[model samples]
Target: MSTVKDVTFDLLRRLGLTTIVGNPGSTEEPFLKDFPKDFDYVMALQEASVVSLADGLSQGLRKPVIVNLHTGAGTGNAMCAILTAYLNKTPLIITAGQQTRDMLLIEPMLTNIDATSLPRPWVKWAYEPARAQDIPAAFMRAYATAVQQPAGPVYLSLPLDDWDQPMDATDVLRTVSTRVGPDPARVTEFGARINAAMAPVLVYGADMARGGADVWADGIALAERLGVPVWASPFCERPPFPETHPQFAGPLPPAIAPLSALLKGHDLIVVIGAPVFRYYPYVPGSYLPEGAELLQVTDDPDAASKAAIGDSLVSDAGLFLKALLPQVNARVAFAGGPLRKPPQTPTGELPLTPAAVYATLNALLPDDFVLTQESPSNIPQLQDQIRVRKPDVSYAFASGALGWTTPAAVGLALAERQSGRNRPVLCVMGDGSFQYSIQGVYTGVQQKAHLIYVVLQNEEYGILKEFAELENTPNVPGLDLPGLDIVSLGKAYGANTSKAETTEELAGAFKGALDHHGTSVIVVPITRALRGLLG
Candidate 1:
């Protein structure tokens, strides 16, 4: 009989999870003992950084990545990033160590408080196996659940002593359940609606990318046939359509009310692989435009079952697009010119604006580079200023969480290196958010990853300041951070660093940093007034 470790390794191999991202601890020693030579473990300093790094790797590699964490405390530390993964719909198999099986009733040291329920509402599934022999099968279940429709994180709590226990070799890995496509008639009905509508708008969501490039092709073909515009979902992690394509309308407004206004003239709104729309607080609006119809195609049963306002089709986005392609007309030309450009800020001798930084970066950066942005104040400005020219090159925090970009940049760089791609990874983070996960730079240095971290030192919590003003309380406490040096932090973490006090300095530093072989940080000195203006 093989030990549990053997079975676990076999299951991981079968699932193609050869690379493990983790922050190991004493409880995980048994599992780490005799670690296989072929398997690679990418370690981080903290559990949160481990999860964020895995999030980026999963998006960049387009595959589920495994992450390991120590029990209880470790899992607790990683919760925020886990929530981020849930919102982003990134596939991850996160495993945490539990106390020895016999110590459950006694509550051993480091034992989690309700280990099984720790990641509730965040993970698609969470389980702690009853028997040591069941660990491998539990892993299989975790993987299957994570990669299934509406992919998200799954959790498994494995006790330390269980790894050395006896387990059957024949029961390690099992077949995953097959996914069924949508009804042919339903797809046809949707296609006909698009064909009949005068001005149909195609709202592409992260699902298009989840469905793969083939699905994107079908979506593009259908959109072109209807002569409609394709708008990417706000806070989207994946490219919904080819950004350089003439029919692309760019990202939809982050605010639902404004988005509704923008879509007011369109007759039909066809949302595929995304929610009708994700909204923030105080964003009051109906789901659809006045007198406009909503149609949705998705593989997630919950998404299909819960879509109250739209005609929901329970099917794979890829299958729906493929079947709907032939039902629509082959060619319809768009009457409008390319999307109207937003006005640029005047280039006066004032402190460099977020718009200027975006414009300059957009002009200088390579088209194939990956960008991870956390400068919330500059989101709207960046959207209008820097346009993504290629698929798989742009990313933002879909979870609306801060402290995500820094670690995510490391993961993106790792993915590029693993895939044999040479394009640089860029991260733009605010000073307040940068402090949250600045430790990630050490991981980048350890991996020798090529990434340029751009710190937009705006010296305050810009979003909170905006919220305070909106709530009629202008003076708020704990919103400002003065006299902090992010460049020194970067240097302490083993990264090449630079400071940009002027536009010329910023441009030169950005170019030189991108050319560097190892990780680098370019800190831009910005003003407090620059807050709440970017997004």
Candidate 2:
């Protein structure tokens, strides 16, 4: 008979989930005791960063990753990143240790109260095994649940003593298939719609990127074949289409009114691998463009069902695109239209505007670098200036949560190293967002992850300030976050830190940092200027 820990470790090795990322505690020690030599453990200072790290690693590896959290407090701290992972459809098997099984009647300290409900609605499944001997089987189920279509995080609570139980000989392993094909009839109908529409617009979503680079390539081919413009989903977390493509239309605004206005001229809108729409700030507008038909192709049935106005089909995004491509014949000749370019906003001196800084970086960024961003106030300017020309080259928190980018960048850098891809990872963050996960720098230093941290210092929560301005509020306290020394913080975490006061300084810092190895942090203090939303 194999022990519970022995069976679980073997299963994890078989599933390629031996790389565990987590922040451990007393309750978790039993599982970690006599840890397998084949398994690698990544430790983060906080639970939130731990989950975010694993989230990015999973995305980069294009596989489900394992995460270990402490009992109650650790799970609570990880909720934010867990939610982000759920929204991003990233597959993760998250395990939390519980108090030992013996102290059931009298609750022990650090014991999770109703542990299954902690990550409710966000996780696809949650459970604590009914018996100590069933722990390994429960984990196998968790893995299958996490990797299924519309994949998301799944939770497992293991009693501290469960690791010592013996497994029966009949306790064997099984395989689970993750992909499901679309209904042929539905695919045929949607393909016919594409073939017949006079002006059909393609709205690409992060799902394509999450699906893998091959799916994104197919989407490009489909767009080119159809001779239609492609617009990225509003606040898309991944780059679905190359921004530099001539037929590429910019992203839609994350507001209903603006999104509706942008899609008005199209006769049909086909949304693929993404929600029909994701809006913010509660702007009153029609669910869709007047007289335009909406059709959504997604792997997520829940997203389809929740769509305000659309006909939806649930299928594997890659398979759907592949099946639909041959059926879509090109009749329109509008694919050669010139891509719009943003006008250069000149800031001739020190204390540059965000636009000027972004423009400078755009000019200096290497072709092979991956970009991660979390500066909402400067998003409009960044959208205009920094152009992504390839799939999987950019990432953001799909949940619109702060603090994800910093640690995610570290994870990406680590993933690149593991995959033998030498591309540099660049993480751009607003000062406020940077502070939320600053300890990620410590991990970067320990791991020697090759990353460039760009701190956009506007000295406040600029996005919230903009929201206040839009609400006509004259004054709002707690909006300012001045006097946060990003350089000192980075240096304390053992990163090479520097400050940039102008575009020239920023250009130099970026160029030098990319050439150097390990982690580098560059703080660019920019003048506060929120640009209007992009069309």
Q: Which numbered prediction scores highest in TM-score against the true structure?
A: 2
Residue 242 C-alpha lDDT in model 2 = 81
lDDT of candidate 2 over 28-122, digit per residue (tens): 99999988888889989999999999988888888888999998889999999999999988899999999998995588899987999999888
Q: Per model, how many backbone clashes are there?
A: 8, 0
What does the lDDT read for residue 143 in candidate 2?
A: 87
Stretches of candidate 2 off by over 4 Å are 169-171, 342-345, 533-535
lDDT of 1 at 50: 94
Each model's lDDT comes to 0.82, 0.87
Residue 415 CA displacement from its true place in model 1, Å: 0.9
- In angstroms, how far off is 87's CA in candidate 2? 0.5
Candidate 1 local lDDT, 1-535, one digit each (tens): 8898998898888878899999998888899888899899999899999999999988889889999999989999999999999978888999998888787888979997698899988999999888888888888888888877778899999889999898678655666643458798888888788778887888999878766667777877877777778888766766778776778887776666777887888888998888766655456676668889989887777777776577888777887777787788765577676664544763645477777777777878876788888877777677667666555777766788776778888999999998989789988888888988888999999899999988888788887887676556866789988999788888999999999877788889988988886899999876667444213
* Clash count (model 1, backbone only): 8
lDDT of 1: 0.82
Model 1 Cα shift for residue 322 (angstroms) = 0.9
